[model samples]
Target: MSRGHRLALAILLLTAATAPVGTAPVTANAGDGALVTAVPNPTADGDAGEYAVVRVPTASTANWTLDDGERVVAVPTDRPAARVALTATPNATRRLTDVPVVAVPALALSNAGERLRLRRNGAAAAALTYRDAPEGDRLVRTDDGTAWRPLGYQPRDVHRYGPATVTGFVLPDSPSLPVETLRSARRRLLLAGYTLTSSRVVDALIAAHRRGVAVRVLVDAEPVGGRTARGAAALDRLAAAGVDVRALGGPRARFDYHHPKYAVVDDRALVLTENWKPAGVGGRSSRGWGVVVDSAPVAADLAALFRADAGWRDALPWRRFRRGKTFAPGASAEGSYPSRFEPTETTAAGVRVLTAPGNAESALVGVIDGADDRVDVIQPTVGRRDGPLLRATIRAAERGVRVRILVSGAWYVAEENAALVEWLNGLAERRDLPLTARVAEPAGRYEKIHAKGVVADGVVVVGSLNWNENAVSENREVALAVRSDALAAYFRETFVADWQGRGRVGRTTWVVVAGALAALVLAVVVARKTIRFA
Candidate 1:
């Protein structure tokens, strides 16, 4: 708000107002599908209530005027120039591939509950009315109808994306997974996670909103039932606080459930292998790993996914949950699981992002297959006895690599994981493989290892991708594979600490204990029979 900066912004605004208007390729008017595609309420350079994006459809004329209820806002004339004072991005391809975009520089369309109209030849063609628009959101109309999607995040597809500087960090340590991390958001906050039940986290977000940060959140609709009811209740609390919240998965949802967990604050992308619930990372109730990426491209990539899911208005629909006390229906997927999002390639210098219901399994197997020396893993759930991930670990052990797996020993996670460990140990004994498995004990600061991460050779794969069939092929998940020793070693040290802690019990010791209990029971039964005979 300095004088010099204000003067520069004013100059830019004047340029946009007098800039030559460019002609469109067609003669279609507002009555056609010539609707607005993007309205960047506040451009990166300009303040709010100063700019907007107007989409002039293909085969349409650019000679049109926009109105803000009572008066005219913009009138176009013949001058060969781009429509917008700033460059705008397309929400999609196909019909909107090459649509001419006009960046209106002087429209005061930032206030909520204001009606903005596009008119041609004195006839109103299209209109947009917003209510509590989230911070940094763009109003878009991709189809012919008037339903505009509030796209809060920007899109940067894979091909157009660039390198990312991936930095590794351990959560509940060093920086610790505290609410203060979110409370520090300055400009925009984009959050997409599996579940959010932590009150401190929610309160921090509310505080951020009060401080004028544009905050938006997307969470899985399931878990509204069962033991995870608090997560749904927290969503209600967030909505009541005026935070723009959206639930993924309802009647017309895409996948079985949405399960990706990450957050973008300004240019930083914080990816995690835990949910936003209390037990996941709050106070280190469970062991988890997180990565902080200081790359704009990486942040933009995640922001794009958020935008797609939040703004999905197509036939394969994504429904928004209403703010209420009653639980929303269609939150659960029952037993039917399906694929929704498409997979794309992500390769940077030392990091790669793999999304599930795609090639995440392949990427995971590829990491294990490429291991040359050792493999260390901490997972809450393992796949089937002979699944791809398990088989890869077995193969790694077969090749004389030191393979160690630390699985959850908490009651709920122990049943499924214990059976897998017993089977794997039996197989390892028979095949003389170097694989060793242990179940984490629930006696320390952390009760369970809810993370899905591995240190194979020098590469680290960490995120919300659980080692299960459903996680890889049914639920929507995300993970980061960093092929750097420094990053991998950070996780490796944490793994080593957990391995040596009293919280982990080896497989061989469990077998011996089970045998001793059986012997004790038989001896007691024999003594009772002798006493009865006497």
Candidate 2:
């Protein structure tokens, strides 16, 4: 009851109020399971929109603080979670990702990069050090959370399938092949392409839809030449028939172009190096290559890819997309060629599905790098000379492998292709390598070359992947690597025929050439007579 006893009791109560909460107070150590998972730099308006993501092992981050060498901001305690995205502008950060964002008024990430430390109780818990941050990209922890890498989007995937029987066909010679494949679909059909204007294909798709088959189509909203009236009409017809139609492209599109040409029909997957237009699938023009694989796994993988692309935020419904759109008048392929190559059913030992913005570039390069006997490539146009695919082909030739590249001779690319051929030949002569490059001469067999195909040893690559950097690095491209000697032989035969300009000109072409020659001769005779008389 004394004054000294009262003072001692008050001091004891004060010490108890400020003491640690438990027998073992939480300690801040570098080995603690906290980590700085992701950091976005140079977003929108410089560093104003930049953000950092930190992950803690326990649910609450109440005691954590983030330090950027110059500024230290307390982690918001309003929302307790294992992962929290701290940013100066919470609204702006939320637009970039769905991760929970916490506004830390003092949070500012340096664009030039620096060390970021996560501290608790004034001690270091974890730290992340980075160099110059790339613009429009985020430095995020890998899947294993061991390292950091710059990425603009989620990591792409490479799908692989086991052995299956594949039916191979070339364009202009077998236009009916792809249509027939579509018609054969009974359960479901997921088609993806850059353009779709082939009347025969549309008819088949409509028929499939009418038969109660689930038919879905996904195309690019803004293709290179823009969406055409014919394409829009076809899409309109499909949409009217209760078919699900979508277009992939917008301000937030994940890919530069939805340029994959493929279809999952029931349990089969059809992959092509052509569009769904007449020139590509109708075989009216273009020397393209396609295949129908009767495999459940392949079809499932393609269907999954279709769903991923078509389900993205950028994929708008056809009706919704065409609301304020004006379509351009587009030309259709009308030329006909002799059916020199027929669709042949063959079995492949394995099929590896490669996608772009992820694995196509590296996988194709690996295929070429593994070639031992011969490597043949046919493309409309190639990327830069130093691109990965071209460099791989050159490397193949350097290692005593016979390499042949046939590029398109279409007027639009004839000059550039010729220059490339000349340069390739010059390099071959200088290095004494077994490499040869040539510009394809259609020779009346078909129109310009449009196939993006490659035959390497016993493997054949067929799909929408162009041997260009953008097509392989930025686009949502798909390609299949079929390992089969028989399939290789079929594609090899077509490649050789096109390369040698040995395609059999149709009877109509012969008649035109003959008529032109006869008229020229008659004109010559008349000119001679007139000159003598004068």
- Candidate number achieving the greatest lDDT relative to the actual structure: 2
> Could you tell me the TM-score of candidate 2?
0.79
Q: Can you list the residue pairs that collide in candidate 2?
A: none
- What lDDT would each prediction earn against the true structure? 0.61, 0.79
Off by over 4 Å in 1: 1-167, 174-178, 224-233, 313-320, 323-349, 502-534
Q: In candidate 2, where is summed lDDT lowest over 10 consecutive residues? A: 9-18
lDDT of 1: 0.61
lDDT of 1 at 185: 84
